[model samples]
Target: MIHQYQLNGYNIVLDVNSGSVHCVDDLAYDIIALYQTTEKQQIINKMLVKYAAVPEINKAEIIEVLDDLAGLKKTEKLFTPDIYQSKAFDFKNRSTMIKALCLHVAHTCNLNCQYCFASQGKYHGERACMSFEVGKQALDFLVANSGEMTNLEVDFFGGEPLMNWNVVKQIVGYGRKIQKEHQKNFRFTLTTNGMLIDDEVIEFANNEMHNVVLSLDGRKKVHDHFRKTFDGSGSYDLVVPKFQKFVKMRGDKNYYVRGTFTHNNTDFTNDILHMADLGFNELSMEPVVCAPDDPYALQEEDLPQLYGQYELLAQEMIKRNKSGKGFTFYHYMIDLEAGPCIYKRISGCGSGTEYLAVTPWGELYPCHQFVGDPKYSMGDVWQGVTNTELQTQFKLCNAYARADCQGCWARLYCSGGCAANAFHATGSIKGTYEYGCKLFLKRIECAIMVKVAEATLDSTATE
Candidate 1:
């Protein structure tokens, strides 16, 4: 299968199955598009007619382009077969070992973000915080079920993980103390709203956390509109300085100023640029996920604007890169040469099987998004996952398993999309969220274009 598009003055062709990307001239691009469906003679004749006005594109060049495409087909670099279909559900047969756990350290928040999917951090439940005992047991459960995996990950997540700062520290300390005994290395992450950030918090996070995710929705107006204090005030003033300080001190460390874009702020590239201009080099802004009826939910009409925004964002990144003020966008970070293996791509995120979320009280769910839902509650930390049926459902949730994704060119790139998003949008883990899929495909397209632009323009611009 092949996908082709013209972006930013380049005609790009991607062999979906083989993961080969080619930058070809206009004549070759047109011919490759017709190579699979039309006969060789017919394709050449069509190309000749289409490019007859151009003196450089003649019958001989058309025939040569066809021959080149045919040679690529023979080498399995173009129009390759989908040989991975048979192994789509191979994850079902493998032993499930836990590798990561998102611990809900605090289910209470100081801010009342109206668009928060977690419902103000309580996750649609009563406000609570994780205890040191439960946190320790969760760590123990992860170690026990992790099999022989040497590296394990634990993310301090929340309404605001800093709200339960003491317990979060204790859990990290306990994990570090026992990692040597178990021959396991624990990599910790902390995601916060910046309400409770202080010098002490920054120092400890810089020392221990592998990465920190700081929430800021770009410009103050956009962020303050949805993310506000319980007293109905904007948090933009309170958080930005703290976040700037956090990132300034976190030199050379991994962190992202993550934000969410909704109908209210479809032109979210401005937010990304605002954050970048604020000295935060690493950034990400995702589309808001909410009910169809919700005012902030991105509608079908919003897609066109969002698509343009992605392209604009990519173009801006290229311009800034050339100017030596380049900032990294999380979604645009694609390593085409050596990405994740096919097995990882097909299986998607190992949510239920290898990764799980622990509630403040130690209840387990496939991920943090599924927390508080009784049906998705797999088990408790001390007991481990007892809901094998749900686990199997998630195990079978892959690109090929979804009927709609079978024909999608971006299927492998997204790994069948997020299981939690699928379940929320369509009421089943195997279901596909068409809306998210459309947005995701656009993002991938722009991401690939950014990569191509950087590689193609870097040397020339420098020279």
Candidate 2:
């Protein structure tokens, strides 16, 4: 389908199926819009009548534009067959092959961040860690269900995964053993708060975990204001040194110093700059996702400032790229040049189909974000997804199912938004969060601008 929108004073046309983007003038935009709903002859006749009074109206040019639009249709760019509808995934016939599992090894955390989504690691339940036996069972379940998939992924997630270091270590060892016997490869990742990172933890993480995500909310004041110890002391001073040490030890590996920005810190460009200034290369700063009523939650009013911050960050990233020291910002790294096709676009992330999250007790969830929420629990390792209906719900949840996403130019890019965020914000898997939609569109626009700037720079250098 053809999606049209105006951004930054430019009229943009997106050919969704063919993945073509065009920047056209107002007349061309109107012509394309009319062409979609009316016949070619009708469009030409209407255009001739509508622009007859204007002396600058070129009938030949209008006809040429019509020819171009018709060519697009012929090539299946403007009006392609509805492959998404024609070949919709039969959820009943979905494979039970699991490719990735996020193991929530710990339901407890060391720091008491005020906006802890997990309710300070207790998840509104009793704080506990996953037993080695439960972890072993989870691995066995993954191996049995993986079916023909050679590479599997296991992410050690929290509370703070480090809090359950022993079990985490045991699970890694067990997974390694399974990998050798089954001729399968396991990719391990760990997400931590960095508060408990000592020499031993660093050594173990460097050797075992393929990637490490360390949480730090930027500057000392902003970080300490929210993330604190049980005694309410700031964790910045405690964690920063440890984080530096860990990063140094885990050299050249996949690691991210991930942070969260709240309503309190909408001017988050400084946070990115601060992290970059601290000699860290890979970084990701995401906005806090929570109920709108929460004081720290990003409200509709914060969007303007947040968008401006993204622009500022984009400019800073451009400057860094020119300065011979470039860092990877997670949001800025959108692969717009080679985005997914229409088939993959409709089915986002394959959450329930190929990926599942395992809780400390061996209960399975669609994702780590839905760990504590029992409503999303598909099954446990022992039962192997008893709730196929829930899995089908997730598998069928896509942009194609949402009316609001039909005409959005950014729909393919976002893939109908996150299901977990949808559940949290609107209590429905198919619901769209307006705040997230806006942020996604703005960021994508900024990414496009970044690419344009780089291209312009290259042209100038060559000249």
Candidate 3:
């Protein structure tokens, strides 16, 4: 399958299956759109009539475009057959080698973010913290189940991981102490609301953590709307300076300031820019996940504005990049030359199988998003995953498994999207969230355009 679009004054055609990207003139672009659907003679006749007034119009040139497309087809770069359907079945039989665990260290938070998916980090259950004993067992469980994989990932996540600071430190120390003995390398990450960042926390994180995620929703007004302290006041003023200091000391380390945008702020480009201006080079802003009836839920009317925002953000990124003041937007990062492997391209994030979330009490869920739901509970860390049936179901969840994703141009880019999102929007994990799908497609388009524009600029400079 092929997808075509005109962006930033360039006509782009993307061969969906083989991942071939082509830049073509208007004549070739229009011809390729009909190349697969219309008869060759009919296409030629239609082009002849359509371009009759043009002095350069000719039957020979139209046929040349067809010839080029045929050659691309012969090379298996265009209209490549769907070969991943059968492979989707193979995942169920593959041995489970758990590679990562998102440890819910703190099931409590200092701030009361109204729009929080985790119900203020309590996961709608209890406000508690994971003990060091539970965390150590979680890490051990990962090592035992990881098979021959030498590298494993552990993310310290919470309502606010720093809220359980001592335990977080002990767990990191334990991971380091045991890594050499097991011949395993544990890469740790921390995600926090930035309410408790101190000099010591920053120093330890820069030394031991692979990456850190700081939660700040861009501008003060946008962030303060939903994220607030227990006293019902905005926490924006309290956290921004701390986050800025943490990031400043972080130097070249990996980090991102993650934010969420709701209907209250559909024009999130301004938020992204506000954060960029604050000296945060790495940033991401995601749409808030809420029920349809929720006041902040993005409606159908918000889509057009959101689309415009993504385009505006992409264009702004290009301009900033040209001036050497560019900041990275997580969603806009795409590597066309080398990306995820074919298996990864088809399947969702290895949740429930290769990756699991450990709750404060050691219960295992598919991932953090599914933490509170008892139905998704796989098992505990000490006992390991006992629910093989649920595990197998997630194993079979792939791009090919979703009928809605089969014909989508952005299917491989998102790998059928988040399973939790699918389950929440629809009744089943195999279903699609049409609302998120639309926004995602727009982002992918903008990402591609930005890459194309950067290449064009670089080529011109060298000339």
Candidate 4:
């Protein structure tokens, strides 16, 4: 069997190179170097019972290895310097590079969903759809900041992006134009309700954009439970069949159907199956956030059920991916943990990378979740990240800066959970992320197990 090494106390991270063990403290090299200086690799199983006891490090072993290599000192080394520089165990690159740009095409939606986070009652603010000029500026920010990346994704999002098709058309048209001019590849995705997904949107999505994130809360009854119009009527009856039509229009490969669920959902399992059967190969399910007058809250037990659903769904998608069936969720939430994490600005998700949301008024914010909110707004596009004399305010607000989160195994990968969610849950951004850091780490572990299992099954089949 191949060597699989894990450190005591820290189970999420694995030191693949030195076959050593150390905590993912700040995802830096210091801990690894410090651990190796103790020669813990020499007595791999030796338990250090006493802290005051002198270390029994073996210098002879080092001399023996050095002597063995002395005869070949003149031989050219095969390894390149770049290989050594990039040897730090990490997923892809370290800098929080922005692979996706979320453009807030519009703020107002055609429908008045009851539980809409950005709805009238929930959100005490208003801004129209981003004009073409603002969209161009957002695109310019990405183009200028995009380093060592040729493929860029532009994700159109809003209360309902389809409500403003003209802006979306102009943005995509301009993005493609600029991409060609700069010799870069530009991809597109959209997040919208199927209520407005007509022929023009379908044509643009299928032929131009990569995916469309349709907001279907679940099956009709469960969906109608929370998501409704301002008239207090369910949107399910309207969106379900249209959802099917939209799915058929673009097919599974091009479009991804996503849904939200709250405690009001009477049948969560059935809803998952409903979307799976509705030809939505890519399905994302998130629990609803409670309101002040909300009667229900998500129970902790729901997580296990969610885990089971993800496992089953991933298995089904794996089979589909192998047999060329039809659709896959693209291994949505797997392969996060199970490796040494490098400390970098960007992690698995783009918290600091190429994702920034610009509102209609040319205000620059971290993501759509912040947008016009002054509390979360990083800076204005007019001012150019200059709200403070420090580095980007978003960087100051980033999840990695908390003292409570330092030395956390999930820090490098999760980059601290969403800063806005942190603020929403607790009074401060750093405050709540501390409480939920372990869960983020746990999610990474769960993803790693799934990826490992998938890899093993594939290897077995090949053998």
**Number of the predicted model whose TM-score against the real structure is largest:** 1
Tens-place lDDT per residue, model 3, 355-442, is 8999999999999999999999999999999999999999988888899998898888898888999999998889999999999999
Q: Which is the winner by lDDT between candidate 1 and candidate 3?
A: 1
Judge candidate 4 against the unseen true structure and give its global Cα lDDT, from 0 to 1.
0.57
Any residue pairs clashing in model 2, and if so which?
none
| lDDT tens per residue, model 2, 117-136 | 88888777788899999999
Clashing pairs for predicted structure model 4, backbone only: 96-346, 96-353, 98-354
Ranking by TM-score: 1, 3, 2, 4
Alpha carbon lDDT at 90, candidate 2: 51
TM-score of every prediction relative to native:
0.98, 0.87, 0.97, 0.69
Task: Give candidate 1's TM-score.
Answer: 0.98
* C-alpha lDDT values of all predictions: 0.91, 0.83, 0.90, 0.57
TM-score, cand. 4 = 0.69
Q: Higher TM-score: candidate 1 or 4?
A: 1
User: Per-residue CA lDDT of candidate 1, range 127-155, in tens?
Assistant: 99999999999999999999999999999
Off by over 4 Å in 1: 458-463
Model 3: residues with Cα > 4 Å off, grouped in runs: 458-463
